[model samples]
Target: MTAELNARLEPTGERWTLVFIRELRKPPEEVWGALTDPGRLERWAPFTAERDLGTTGDTTLTMIDGDESTPLPATVRRAEPPHLLEYTWGDDLLRWELEPSGAGTLLTLRHTLPGEDGLGPMVASGWHLCLDVMERLLDGEDVRAVRGEEAKEHGWEDLRDRYAKMFAG
Candidate 1:
């Protein structure tokens, strides 16, 4: 079978990275709080992450879907209050960097997945959706409907295109 396209931005450079940046309407501390809080994660993404909102280390994010759940074991590599948070997601290094953007906060997500065994596209899609949800959550808007619409529109072709573009760029 062929590989899937990315759900968000295409990969770039030799690093095989998927990067997404969004300016949250809220301040840095509020944005950071939302991201760190596990209860807030579920409201946006379809996962329940278990970890200390203040301390960062080895944390497990269990994806919630119906009655099933998949535990994604990860380790926090770095953490700086209301600024930066970097972690390992499977074979990829996921980094969440926040910056002051006027009265709002600019949040950038960078994911680096090594190798090219088709995992890049898969993870990109998830990040895209999660970022969308995060955006909605920051705006205090309902994200379930938005996620459903995005899934309906993109599907797998989007995933493959994302990877192909990453390879080309």
Candidate 2:
């Protein structure tokens, strides 16, 4: 399935926000588990979490780019199980809101970045692939994570261009 590029920008004090929404066919709890559980996250997320995200506490998120790995200090600010989750990844703030939508869940993510580095489209494209893989995994499909440079094989650059055009006008 082609993932929709449903991303928008908003002003939030000193930082900018990338508001993204995706509708999943899975229940809220299932989607919440994929977002919070380290094992489940590894299956779809681009980074690996050091601890369970269900609890509000300090954690580390390691981004593996080829053989290079960068460890970023992160903290779980709020975790309300199947409803809400707010966390900080390095200098960026990510807030997740989940609502039950019929037999599925409507997932909303607000990614706040420092200043306006013009990274909104790039982040939006990256998240589009991540959510696509997440949707496949939740649908009981065995698929490898298409991230980083590997994302080019999955039309990430095209998606990014699309987002860029949308944001520019």
Candidate 3:
């Protein structure tokens, strides 16, 4: 756990940035697989991801609104399997950096928003939910559906609070 999980906000010219870091009791390759593999991503994320992962070329990741079946375009900037993944959403940059930590892996997520306006909160919640789903999936838990509603209703601050309580032992 880190300060990023507290919903700490960083000022970025016009936009705001949110960061989240977690240490998993799993290998970097396993974490990387869940993130870069479409089959694994669909097991955790709300939308079914379709991408040409494990390749050098850039790919598009869409966050499909399951209810509406609409796709939100997400651009993949860089994908280095088992190491890093960077994607762009609107004016935000979503990055995942993985490193081996002791016997597990340390995952750091940096989500930068373009402005401190409406997009900030939405992005925060979205990232929070995604992270939550990732956490569960990594633990071999079943989290098939998109839990966006939790983020939508609670907002960023509430998301942190809920995660703290839900995951706290």
Candidate 4:
């Protein structure tokens, strides 16, 4: 992927918000299923929801892998099915907005960090790859979740450098 398609970061007071916009060749409903359905999420997302994340409810999102596999508490701030879904992942807030665009869906992901941290590039790179995997899944490609070393081996470092430059200034 090119740097132009990379996530864009904006300084919001003490916090930094990253926005990733992708035009998918699928309907909003299909994309929404991939985002909220645990089965589909496991194919690409870093975590899996304990409960159905399709409504305005609370759920536990268990990290796929980590030193401590503790489930993080998450609360749905907004859920409008196939349109908008906002939730809190630990201290950060993630908002996904979907709209009909031509024959496809315009998906926008906004992740707001609690503060300006040097980990922005890494996080952006991870999400960049995650989104790419998600898109490939939607395109009927059987791709598995890529993280940690697997991510680095899949050009994540290059993405991280590009994202760092984009977020630098």
lDDT of 2 by residue, 23-126 (tens): 99999999999999998888888788999999999999887665667889999999998999999999999999999999999999999988783898889998
Q: What RMSD, rounded to one decimal, does every model reach?
A: 5.5, 1.0, 5.2, 1.9
Model 2 misplacement above 4 A: none
Off by over 4 Å in 4: 1-4, 66-68
Error of 1 at 130 (Å): 1.7
Per-residue lDDT for 1-169 in model 4, tens only?
A: 5224557887878897888888888999999999998899888888888877888778888876544465889998898999999999888889999999988899899889887757688888888888888989998998898756678877889988887888777
Tell me, by lDDT, which candidate is best: 2
- Across 1-169, the per-residue lDDT of candidate 1 in tens digits comes to 2122323444555556667666667888988877778777777664667875446688887766556677888888788989998877666677889999999988888878787535666665565666666767777876552233345364535754665577457
Whichever of 1 and 4 has more TM-score, that candidate is 4
Global lDDT of each model?
0.67, 0.90, 0.66, 0.84
lDDT of 3 by residue, 36-99 (tens): 7888887766555567455545455655553454455677778887889887754567788999
Clashing pairs in 4: none
TM-score of each: 0.73, 0.96, 0.73, 0.91
Clashing pairs in 2: none
Candidate 4 contains a number of clashing pairs equal to 0
